[model samples]
Target: MLTTNDLMTIDPETVTADVPLREVVAVMNRANIRQVLVVDGKKLVGIVTDRDVRLAVNSPLTTEEPLQRLELLNGFKAKDCMTSNPRCVTPETPIHKVAELLSMYKFGALPVVKDDALVGIITVTDLLNQMALIPEPKS
Candidate 1:
């Protein structure tokens, strides 16, 4: 059975929980990724998605001034907007199970962990890439 280890992105982009949201946006832009794993050392702690950053910076009730928006972004840290203790899968977890969890939870990715330490991350794009490599069976 294909597992996360077979298709996961090793050393995926990560950020410390104390990282400022502005920096998170920069990382995402530089990496061209939709989400980033929040970690403390090697341990998985949370996740912050692009949507989270967008919402944080573009709240309708908040001021429209760019200066205020900048302040808001700088004031918020990853921990403030991140989903704490996000569900995770081990590297040995089957890809189908990961797919199921992603579908059920509507998650873009799931952190891959081993021995309580972050190892990698498996995203919807990862599964799709693997699927593309599979050969078609006889009709």
Candidate 2:
């Protein structure tokens, strides 16, 4: 049975609450990742994703603004757009269980915690990778 720790991306890319959204996008682009954990000190506080940025950019309030203006304003800070109180999993959680939770809740990723400390993250991509590694069942 695979555990979350076995498939999770350890020391995953993270951003500080005060980091500008532009910087976050740059980091995500550089890392080729779609999601980033928002941290304060050493504690995981929230999560930010490309979807969040898209929502902010496409919001009615910002729709009429010029691209540059929108980017400048929307790119304020991670805390301004991050999803707080994000659902999390533990290192000991079974991979299948995490998959179930993610599917049931429509979550793309889940932070892994131990003693309330951030350890890693498991994303849908990670789960897909794990599934790919599994052998096919006999017919």
Whose TM-score is greatest here? 1
lDDT of each: 0.94, 0.88
lDDT of each residue in 1-139, candidate 2, tens digit only: 8899999999999989999888888888999998999988668999998899777666776556578645764567999889997999999999899999999999899999888779999999999987898899999
List of clashing residue pairs for candidate 1: none
Clash count, candidate 1: 0
Runs in model 1 lying further than 4 Å from the true structure: 136-139
At residue 95, give the lDDT of candidate 1.
Answer: 89
| TM-score (C-alpha, index-matched) for candidate 1 | 0.93
Cα RMSD for candidates in order: 1.5, 1.8
Per-residue lDDT, model 2, residue 37, is 95
Given candidate 2, what's the lDDT at residue 139?
100
